[model samples]
Target chain A: MTVDFNAIPLSQLSIGSSCRIGEIGLNGLLRRRIQDLGITPGTTVECLRRGPSGDPTAYVVRGTTIALRKEDAYQINVFPI
Target chain B: MSITTEKDFLQELNKEAETIRLSYVTKLGDRIIADIYKNAEQISKNVILNDTNKKNWTLKLDNYLTSKIFGYPFMLLVLGIILWITISGANLPSDMLATALFSLQEILSRGFLDLGAPAWLHGILVFGVFHSVAWVVSVMLPPMAIFFPLFTLLEDLGYLPRVAFNLDNLFKKAKTCGKQSLTMCMGFGCNAAGVVACRIIDSPRERLIAVLTNNFVPCNGRFPILIAIGTIFGVGALTGQLQALAVAGIITGVILIGVFVTFAVSWILSRSILKGEASSMVLELPPYRRPKIASVVYRSIIDRTIFVLKRAVSVAAPAGAIIWIVANTYIGEISILNHLAGWLNPFAQAIGMDGYILLAFILGLPANEIVFPILIMSYISSGTMIELESLAELRLLFIDHGWTWLTAVNVMLFTLLHWPCGTTLLTTHKETGSKKWTLAAFIIPTTVAFTVCFILTQTVRLLGLG
Candidate 1:
């Protein structure tokens, strides 16, 4: 099976870009937690801002602001809407 | 209809869910959200475009607040300003209250003498109970009055979630929910409250981690001690505004250390017994609004300030009386207080604290607000509480008792990292419902306090830095 090489991780999305979440690459508790926060596949997420360290970026998801570390964000595949 | 027990029904539901593909749950969630959005779009038209621009302004402000270059510095500056305001504003009122209370003590003592009452009775009632309560009020009330309102103002303006947002990565790295930052903020007000606030975290493991570490942050009762010591030893050399700023900075540093320890302990717990994956959180940063002054004052003063003060006073009163009894009651020409202090001296010395300080902490277990009073009572050998008029006199008193900068540093560190008070421990017990976990909560911070102080003391002594 060939991977979708053009599908970028959510962490790479520039500020102000709106995108739809694709397959979440994490499983178990982390996956459940992400879904519980309404970041399921096909949901729209907008990149908001980076923190002082520029690693943890905030995103707008389901009318709430959620922050995710770049490492965790890397596991979330998304494409610009 | 057949009767089905709740547990059996839940088990049946779980089995049914398990039979389906796991990805179905994700699909179901997506479908639910998508349908909701579809319904919303059908009912509301052009709402997004109109509000989007207006909301983006707030989002833009949030961007700046949480920006890479400005977020942390801005947070620190705000914290420093709050501390500075509390310190400077509290000083005059505290002094005034002390004067008024002490004068009332003088009047009451003279009245007792005139009524031919015994000196011991007067000492216990007036000096031990009344003085301790008065000291707590005067020392704690002003700062709480100023600090709580300001904190409430920030809360009303919805800045706290931003704080949690900024600290989210740090807490996540510790394998806990980012919401723990908000709970820790509550801990700065009261650890028991913080313990209760941990309920906001949905994951049981993360909630437990939060409950155990809530005591790292000094509560309002401990703030007086931090400020007093920070003022005297940490910044006593400075003058005027700079002095207050330095003191605030020192307290801020102490608070930062507490935050650091919270993270460290949370990380250790997650990697060890409470090991688990961190649960993600979607924190809603509510749009900032102008805080209503009336509600801010009422809620902060009536709800927070008075509530906390009442709790502190309830414990402090009884602890004060007990401290007096210990200081006055003699065992072979040495008061019990001194005897106990003497017994703890070797260990305390190794940690750069004295027996009296250690004993004060032990006696102060009920309420931290009374620790300074207990120390003063023991130090003076007066069998009654005393409040010095000025920081200079307080410094001289400590110096006369052989307190150096190392002692001050160790005391501050110990105070910052010591065991949770009786109330916090009780709250932990209630929250965790496990004697073992509550014991862990008690022991963890106590152990950290001793180890930190020991290392700092030994290092300073070995390096001849002190």
Candidate 2:
């Protein structure tokens, strides 16, 4: 079996980077919410900007701007496209 | 088990799915989304990049608005300018309306006397009901007229969604919806409407949280009190444009405190009994367009201004009659209003406000537009409502009642933080479909108001600053 270890958490992606979500590591309503916002695996998301606090970052997903806190973003695995 | 009936087979399948759901939601979600994308890619046409030429100037402007460095300052500047416009523009029209309405009240009183109507009948109909309505119109209409159109203009121009985008993070930290900010802005026009606006939030838990905390944003009714107190105590020393700017700035600061309380209470509720995880939101920042002035005027005036005014007047009329009766009817040597106020006085004083102010708040529950008038009436022991000509006269009225700067500050604070008016309570009840949640909404802000005022008063007194 081959292991692909280059995938990183969405929170680690820098501004202006476009990536496809690899895996969602959240559960239940939180997972459903992210998916509902079109941040599901295989969907392309572009990093917009961090908030003034820099913990919550905004990403443009499926033609809408969505904000994710660091903890939530960490649960989503993404790979640069 | 293999040859079971259809119902049993379905039940077994559901049990299987539930266990699988608990363990592999992440892997399952990834596979499903990947399959969806794969299917879409097969059916779609050639994709094009570099679509900037088709994007209009609105997108370029959005880049600045949603930019980290420029967004917060720009939001504040726009808000400050709107508030400044409201404060300065509302003055002349409010005074003119007051003069016009009061004169009409005098004429109506004289006409009733000439028509052989008894004094008590005249008092109940003209002085009680009519006076309250008059006060509501004079105090409320101008600000709403000015503020609502400006707010709607922003909404129409598509900046409001950007507001939701900017505040989304803070609200997410509080475990509520970012759309709550838009509803809170709606609250500035009318809290009942704001409570109704909670429908936009899809998550039921976050919607309830938004509904419960909407009262932290002061509505049009309370804005009169805030503006008056702000002008008198907050920035009264300044003159001309400086005074107006100072008042606007102070009101904005008070509003910021209200927003803080909203966040704090939301955070507490989300962590406590109403506990839940924050849900993600997909906010589409709509493109900016030129706001149509005609529709802006019509919608703001007809839909918001008149609609809110009508609701307030309906509640205020009955409240006025009750207030009149309370002020006129004596228990022992004191009028019932005074007796009630006196009963509440000790606690009120401990919070830096006197009994009459507290009593006014209690009686003014129907509509907050009349709290100021009721206070003035109680202070002068007038059986009917009264209005002074200017802020200076209003200041003297308060001073005569032993009010200090401490009282003024606390009154403004209490006014801003207290429970929703009667209409908002009803709206909450309807929205939540539970009496228990409505009761919680009422109790929460009232408790916060009392606690905040008590702490401020005690701290000031203990430090001998008051």
The weakest ten consecutive residues by lDDT in model 1 chain B span B41-50
True contacts kept of each: 0.48, 0.30
State the displacement of the C-alpha of residue A64, model 2, in Å, after optimal TM-score superposition: 4.3
Q: The CA-based lDDT of model 2 is what?
A: 0.85
The per-residue C-alpha lDDT of model 1 at residue A14 equals: 96
Compared with the true structure, the alpha-carbon lDDT of candidate 1 equals 0.87
Estimate the TM-score for candidate 1: 0.89
> Model 2, B1-466: lDDT tens per residue?
4656878989999999988886786666667866775765555535635344434566577678867788888888888889899988888898898899889998999999999998788888887788878878888888899999999999999899888877888898899888999999999998999999999998899999999999999999999999998898877688768888998898888898999999999999999978999876656655577899999999999999999889888888888888878888888888898888989999999999999999999888888888987887778764334556688888877787898899999999999999899889998999999999999999999999999999999999999999
Q: C-alpha displacement of B194 in model 2, angstroms?
A: 2.3
**Model 1 residue B168 CA deviation in Å:** 1.8
Scored against the true structure, residue B378 in model 2 reaches a CA lDDT of 74
Q: After superposition, how far is residue A14 of candidate 1 from its true place, in Å?
A: 3.1
State the lDDT of candidate 1 residue by residue for B354-430, as single tens digits.
Answer: 99999999889998999998998889874334458788989988998999999999999999999999999999999
